[model samples]
Structure formats: structure tokens, C-alpha cells
Target: MDRIKIKSVTTLAEHWGALRQADVEYRAADGSLHHLKREIYDRGNAAAIALFDPARQTVLLVRQARFPALLNGDPAFMLEVCAGMLDGDDPFTCAHKEALEETGHAPRNVRKICNIYPSPGAVQEKVALFVGEYDAQTRQAQGGGLAHEGEDIELVELPLDEALGMIESGELTDAKTIILLQHLALERGA
Candidate 1:
């Protein structure tokens, strides 16, 4: 922050999320001052969880429609780990809630992997990543996400190896999901 100086910020939109145009002067590494304007999307922070069943060597995931991806000419339906905006809860709580609501599993031994800014150049959204263990007994509900919220998610449980294969096959392209799956693979020495 010391190397950056804010000139001004103007709100451009605030419907689904806040979008602002920022005017800033930055001190370059070469001791030069540079002025620029950039639009930023502020959609708050989020949490995502990868639910792994160690005994079965499987992971639970959800497939849902993503309008943004559809708009980008990618598939409308995306296979992803359970995730949600924090709304007001802490990262761990949000991760657990989203896991239960999107995958029908109550996770245990949840551990944080890291925090990541998915689109740091233009978006102000940091997603907390976590890995949690799940089993048959943890399936407390038939999770398809909330109908009222427009989330018609489909649960998919696959062997860890198959899930990893999807990444190379272009079936699973979500960033957060990829990170979690790779983390699990590394953890299991796969």
C-alpha cells in the first residue's frame, strides 16, 4: 500500500455486486510513478471445500449451471467442489455449510489449504480453500443445493484417480476444484 497511492474511486455498478473504477498512482520498481485506472469487481470473499472419502478413495463434487462460463462459450454445466460466498460467516463455517448444502455430506477434520484470489487483477474475491474427510455416515441429506437460489446441482462421486483424469480430459476445469484435487493427490502420495 505504501508503494501505491489512491487517486479516486467511482462506483460504476452495484446490482449483483459492486464494481468500481479506481484511479491510482503506483511507484514502479525503477522509482517511476505510473498512473492508471482499473475497474474492480467486489463480490466479497468465499469458501470452498473438497470432500474426500479416504476409505473409498473417492471425492464428492457437484455439477451446476454457470451463466458466466456459458457466456464465455464454455459448457454451462461445471463440475466443481462445494463452494459458497461467506455472506457473513467465517471461512470454515461457510465451507462446512456449503459442503452440506451442495454435496449432502457433513465434513470432518476440515483443514485449510490456503487463500487465493481467483481474479486478483479485476476482482476482489478471496476464496478460502479447505479439505475435509467424509464417509457414508456423513451423508445426511440429498444435496442438490437450494432450489430457490437457482442452484440445481447434481452430486457426483468418483474415484480420486478418475476425478484427476477429468482435469487432464478437460471435464473438470474449475480452478478451485483443480487445486483441491491436486492437494488431495499430493497428500495421498498419488
Candidate 2:
């Protein structure tokens, strides 16, 4: 607090998410004062889960439309692990709910993997990541995502090795999904 002084925070835009510009002064490493202005997007925190089936050696993921990615000249449809905003729920509960809603499988033995700020430079979103086991017995719904929420999701099941290969082929580009997959591989000593 002594090193950083926040001069003012002005809301630039407010809609589905908030955009604010912060004017601040910072003490540099050499004890020099530096003034800076930064714009931040606040969309709240979220949770994500990777569902792995040991018996089948497979992983469950979802594909959905992402306008931002399309705008960036990437594919509009992105393949990613199950994830959703916390919506005031705890991370663990959000993880489970997102899993069930997006993957059609309620995971068992859910375990926390890590927490990450995917885009800390501009967005104030901390995602809680988890890995959990799933099998035939866990299928509880069709899990196509909520249509009313403008989500049209496609469920995808891939062999672990194939999924890893997709990462190399540029097919799987979502950061959270890649992290969870690599974490699982590390856990398996692969």
C-alpha cells in the first residue's frame, strides 16, 4: 500500500461486464515515482474442471462459440474443459455444477488442481481449476449447456493421448484446458 498510490478509478463502460480506468502512482525499484493509467475489465471469478476416465483413458471436453476468439482471427468454436462463472457459489460447487452442466457427467473424487489468473494484465478473473474422475455411472444429463444463456455446446470425448496431440496441432488452444491436461499428464508421470 505504501509503494502504490491509487489516484482515481473511473468507470469507462458497464454492461455484461465492467470496464474501469485506474489512475495511479507507483514507487519504482530505484525509489522513483512513476504515474500510470490502466484499464481493467471486471467480470468476476470462475471455476473449471477436467474430467478424466482412468478406465477408458479418456477426457471429456466441450466445444462452444467464442466471439472474442473469432474476432482475433481464430476459430469461433473453441474446445475447452467444463467451466463457468462462480455466480456467487463457492469454487468447488461451481466446478461440480459446471461439470454436470457442460459434460453430462458428475465427477467423483473432485480435487483442486490450481488457481490461476488467466489474463491478469487486463481482466480481474481468477479461475479455480479442478480435476475429477468420471465414468459411465456418472452420466446424469444430456449436458448441452443452457440454450437460454446463448450457449450451444457440443460434448466431446477424446483419448488422452489424442487430446494431447491436439494441443500440438493447434486444435486445443484454451489456456485453462491446456493447463488441466498438462497437470493430469504430470500427475500420471507421463
Residues 1-190, candidate 1, lDDT per residue (tens digit)? 9889889999999987899999999999999999999999998999999999999999999999999999999999999999999999999999999999998889999999999999899999999999999998998888999998888999999999999999999999999999999999999998
Q: Which stretches of candidate 2 lie over 4 Å from their true place?
A: none
- Candidate 2 clashes: the total is 0
List the candidate 1 regions with Cα displacement exceeding 4 Å: none
lDDT for model 1: 0.95
Which TM-score value belongs to model 2?
0.97
For residues 1-190, could you state the per-residue lDDT of candidate 2 as single tens digits?
8999999999999998899999999999899999999999998899999999988989999999999999999999999999999999999999999999887888999999889999999998999999999999999999989888887899999998899999999999999999999988888889
Most lDDT-accurate candidate:
1
TM-score of each: 0.97, 0.97
Q: Give the 10-residue window scoring lowest on summed lDDT in candidate 2.
A: 144-153
Q: How high is the CA lDDT of each candidate model?
A: 0.95, 0.94
